[model samples]
Structure formats: C-alpha cells, structure tokens
Target: MQAVKNRNSSINSIVESVFDKDAANFWLQKFNPLWSFNQALGKIINKDQTAVDTVSLTIQTNKKFKLGEAGQHHPVIVTVNGRCFERTYSLTQLDVDHVLLTVKRVDQGIVSNWLIEKAQLGDVIEFGQPYGDMLLPQPSSPLLLLAAGSGITPMYSLIKAALKSNVSTPIQLMYWMKHEADAAFKAELEMLAEKHANLKVQLFHTQSEHPDSRLNESYLNQVSNLENTTVYACGPSGFVSTAEQVFKSAQSFKSEAFSLSHLASDDVGFINVTLTKSHKTVAIPKGQSILVGLEQQNIQPTHGCRMGICNKCACNKAQGSTKNLVNGATNTEPGHLLKICVNSAQSDLTIDL
Candidate 1:
C-alpha cells in the first residue's frame, strides 16, 4: 500500500508538471466554455431593453462567481477588438446562479457600446470580485434613495433587496433622467410601490415640456423625516455633491458617482510621468486623472472601475506629487500607493507601471 501511494503521488506530480495552468484551462474550456483553472465567468442568458439607451443582461455565472451585496459594483472584463477591457457595473442578483447587469449606452463608451450591440446570448464574460460600501444599513431606518441616469442600477438592487427583506421602514426613491422614455424599470418600480405601502417612487424628467429642476435643496422638501432617514445618492459627481450638501443633516449618508467632475485647479499644464517598468516617460496633464492621461498617450494600464472604487489601477508612486481628484487633496509622499483612476499627476513622477 505504501508503494502504491508513492507511485500515485509521483504520477500526479508528473501530470501537474506536464499540464500547466494555461494548457489545462484550454482543454477544460473546450469541454465547458465557462470552465477554467481559476476565473469567474458568466454566460449571457437573457437580454432586454430597459430604456431608450439602456439594456439589462441576465448573466448565468459559473460556480466561481460570488454574489455581492445589493449596492455594490462588479468588475466585468470583456474582449473587444482583440483587446481586453474592464468596466465596473452594478449588478442585481436574481438567483443563486444568475445576476442582472444594466448598462446605459454612452455616446462614445467602448465597453458599453460593445455590450449593448455586439454581445449575444451564450457569450461568456469574466467578473472580478464586487466592491462598494453603499449597502443597506442594519436595523433599517427610513430610507431616501436618489439616482440619476444609470445610477438607478444599484438603487434598484438595494430597493428590491430591502423590499424583499420585508423591512417596514419607508423607502422613498427619486430617480431623475433626461426624458420619461429614458426611465428604466418604470413599470416594475410602480408595481412595487403600489404593493408596498411603505414605498414611494417618483420620476423626474429634466428635459420634458414641464422640466423639473435638477437636484437641489428644494428636493429635500419632498423627503419626510429627513432628519431620521438614511440617504443614498448615486449620479454624476456634481449631482452627488449636491445631494450630499442638501442631505447633510440626514442620519446617515452614502453615495457613489458614476462620472467624476473634473476638479477646478489653479495648477495647469503638463507634468512628466516616468513608468519604471516600461522605461518610458510621458507628459500627463495636471488636474486630470493619471489613468486618462496615460490612455491619451496610448498607454493602457490595467484598470477597472475608473471611479476609483476597485483599486485595480493603483500603483506605486515612487517619486513626486499627485492630487486626489475626488477630494482635491494633494500628496507629495514618495513610495506611496496611488490610485491612478482618481489621482492626477502634480509633478514629474516616477511610478511602478
């Protein structure tokens, strides 16, 4: 028995040495397209047009995929034109094996356009671990959810989870879009509001004949128990900033911005960025994100969720200064970690690519 065990162990070691991970995975994928040595993959099972420029995809994930909280973003990776790109999208779990991802087609968005127009059912995509902190609070308080444009995705997930949990707290959702035709989940949200007496749904169209003003202090008037409610806002940076200021007195406030507004900085002009690994130097614009600057120079670094939540674009700032675009804070420390997605080069910098 001891001899047989030793022989079996030797054979296993030989097999491991012969079949490297990539070779093994290639064969595994041939048998099952979603199978891999270690990759979270999902197949597009269903697709539906949610709005004029939005589509909701139902993805059936493999066993490697892990579900996240209601209000979190997942880094989805897809190949477009022989190049891999990653984008973070808010997902709603439909069941143990499936989740829903809604994407709005931006005018020039590469991943969005591809996902909307090119991806088909049975196509597999990769998903990284989910990230975000705007989850439902414990011991639920009366809730106020504010969303604009595609920001409604996560709020929809949170609202569904909150309602399904049978939390008796009042949930008021105010969603703003350019037009009524751009509203996603309108009928579903209305049905949910009708069934739940504690729920309220309001849609605002900013470009309608009777145009509603953008989110402002006056919007707080519609939210009852503002002092006691937990406020969650998602939108462009400007709208989120406005929501934060107007709801400053709420019990708790959390927000996520899909697009960051550029910081108004007195420091203008170009700064040099030296990529240590690539052994290249490039001039990056001051007061703009390093990731954007690198992209402008055709240097595509690994990045996910350009809004700075995933930390996939973080790198070592070996030298010089950078400014955090989100908070307008400057850091001059050397050998510190920097997230290129939300930080701008402030000086001649050495970075670990």
Candidate 2:
C-alpha cells in the first residue's frame, strides 16, 4: 500500500508537469486556479433531496486528495452571485474519494444559502486542506461527543471514524438542536448507534415537543460516567462554553466554534483602517478586529479557520500598529504580516486585505 501510494504521487506529479492546469482550465474555468495534490478539487455527486432547509452535498475528489481528521473542517470555495466565498465546512469522508458536507442555511448566511439553494451536481468546488484538532485522540478511551445545530457535521465524522477504526472504547453522543427535522444527520446517526453496540446516541430538541431543550448545567450534572471520558463539543460559542465548564473535571475536553470570540470590548474610540489595495478607509470599533469590522461593512475578505490557526486571514500591515489577540503582542513595525482574525486596529492602519 505504501508503494502504491508512492506510485500514485509520482503519477500526479508527472501529470502536473505535462498537462498544465492553466491551458486546460482557462477555457474550463476562467483564470485557471491551482489544481494541486494538496488541494481538494471536488465535484458534487449528489444532494439529499429529502433534507429540508439544510443541504448535504456528496463530493467526489481524486486520489490525490488530502485526508482530514475526523473532526476537522475544509475551507471550501464556491462562486455565488459573481462573488467567491471561502467557508469552512466539517467534512465526513464517505470513502477514499468522496466526502459529505452538510450546510445549514442561516438567516444572513450568504454562502450557506447559496450552497443549499443554487449549488448543483457536477459543479466544481475548490477546498483547502482539512484542518483542526478536535478529533478522537489516538489510543482512544471513553469519549463523549456533544454537538448542536451544524456542529453535528464534525461529531458525525468522529463517531463514524471511531467505529470504523474498530475502536472498542465507548462513544456517547448528545446532539442538541431546535427540532428533530432540524437535525442534519439524524437518520445516519441513529443507524450508526444501532449498528455499533458501543455507541450511544441522544438528542435534545430545544424548541420541539421533545424533552431536554438545552445543554446547560442541570443537564450536564445528570450525565453519567463523564469523569472517565474525554468530552468534545462543537457548536455555537454558548454551547461550547457550557460544555467546557461542565466537563472541566473530565479526563479531557475540547471544542470548536464556528466564529471567533471578540476581544473584550474597550471604549478606546474608533480607529481608521485603510485597505491598501482597495484604497478604502473604514472606521473600526475600538476592540473589534479588522476581520469582523470588514465583514460588518459587507467586505468579504478571504479567510478560513477564523481562529488565527490557519494563515488564510493573514495580511500585510504596510503601515500601522496592531495588537494580536491570541498573544496580546503588539506589532508597530511598518511592514509585517499579521493575522487579521485575532488582531485589532491599534492605530490608523493600512493593510493589504
């Protein structure tokens, strides 16, 4: 298998040299983009018609695809309304060549709605490498998977991977959502739990007639055997925060939130932020990072893993002072690269966003 994988790599390298992506895809896709082995060039194979407002896409990629951890996300790019959007979606590998990406349409979710309503089969989409560390750790032990809303995407992956890998450790899943229909992978999760004796599944419908409408302290206290398990939660900030606090005494606990938390708000007044390339100036709030401020003003800058882990949101600070929220380090140098996801406007700044 190692030799076969090596041979496949050699073949892709040879193909990249002979058949240039630019010459072929220029007519196929304008301004031919990089079609590298490290990238996921996927074509939508199918969509769940039975799925309601949320849509699940099955994408088929080539053998050169980079495999992702069970609880990681891929930054997928799709062109919608003449604008390209890079949104991160947790990927569930159906096979070596296929993945399932479930996107829920939010009220103001430009990309999410576009994907569900407009994206069609055979449409091509580019994806960054799968990333994030919220997976079942090696040498598995008892695990509890807590998820809400779209957070089920990654937790689903983790559960399937755990069972597929033949890990005998028990996996307890408690998924929270507004209603039964709102649960994206309800059917598959039930099947998985039924098939794997070691897997347990529970659902909390926050707005439905079902019991248990929340994942709060009261619910957390009733959970059994949590002391010996690793708790993994993914969802909105509030859900994750609650899980963190509730499971603090567990063996281990981790979480993934869709959005980054803003630094503590300060009354430092507005700061001038100048976009060097666009030649536009905007007044950003005192504590708000440039990324959040830009998004508020309808400026969609390319970014992924909004946690400053991926360099997707990194930009050049040609001239200005910026403070990194992750480390609280301030950079006053004229020309330096900084991650806008965690940095805020420290002064009148010019950035190549």
* Stretches > 4 Å off in candidate 1: 1-18, 263-267, 274-281, 297-300, 316-321, 327-337, 347-353
User: Model 1, 198-314: lDDT tens per residue?
Assistant: 999999999999999999988877988888999999988778878988999999999887888766769789999999999999998887889999999999998889887778899
True-structure Cα RMSD, model 1: 3.7
Structural similarity to truth (TM-score) of each candidate: 0.87, 0.76
Predicted structure with the largest lDDT when compared to the true one? 1
Could you tell me how far off, in angstroms, the CA of residue 28 lies in candidate 1 after the best superposition?
2.6
- In TM-score terms, which candidate is top? 1
For residue 158, what is the lDDT in candidate 1? 96
Where does model 2 exceed 4 Å of error?
Answer: 1-21, 27-39, 260-268, 272-283, 294-302, 307-311, 314-339, 342-353
The CA lDDT of each predicted structure is 0.91, 0.80
As a whole number from 0 to 100, the lDDT of residue 42 in candidate 2 is: 85
Query: lDDT by residue for model 2 over 1-353, one digit each (tens)?
Result: 99999999999889988986656655544532334434458888898853457888898886457868888888888888787778888888888888888888867888888888888888888887877888787778899999988888888889888888999988899988887778877888889889999999998888876556577777775567777888998877667766788788888888776654444546488888889889899888767678988888888787787766567888888998888654346789987987887788888999986
Given candidate 2, what's the lDDT at residue 252? 85
Q: For model 1, which pairs clash?
A: none
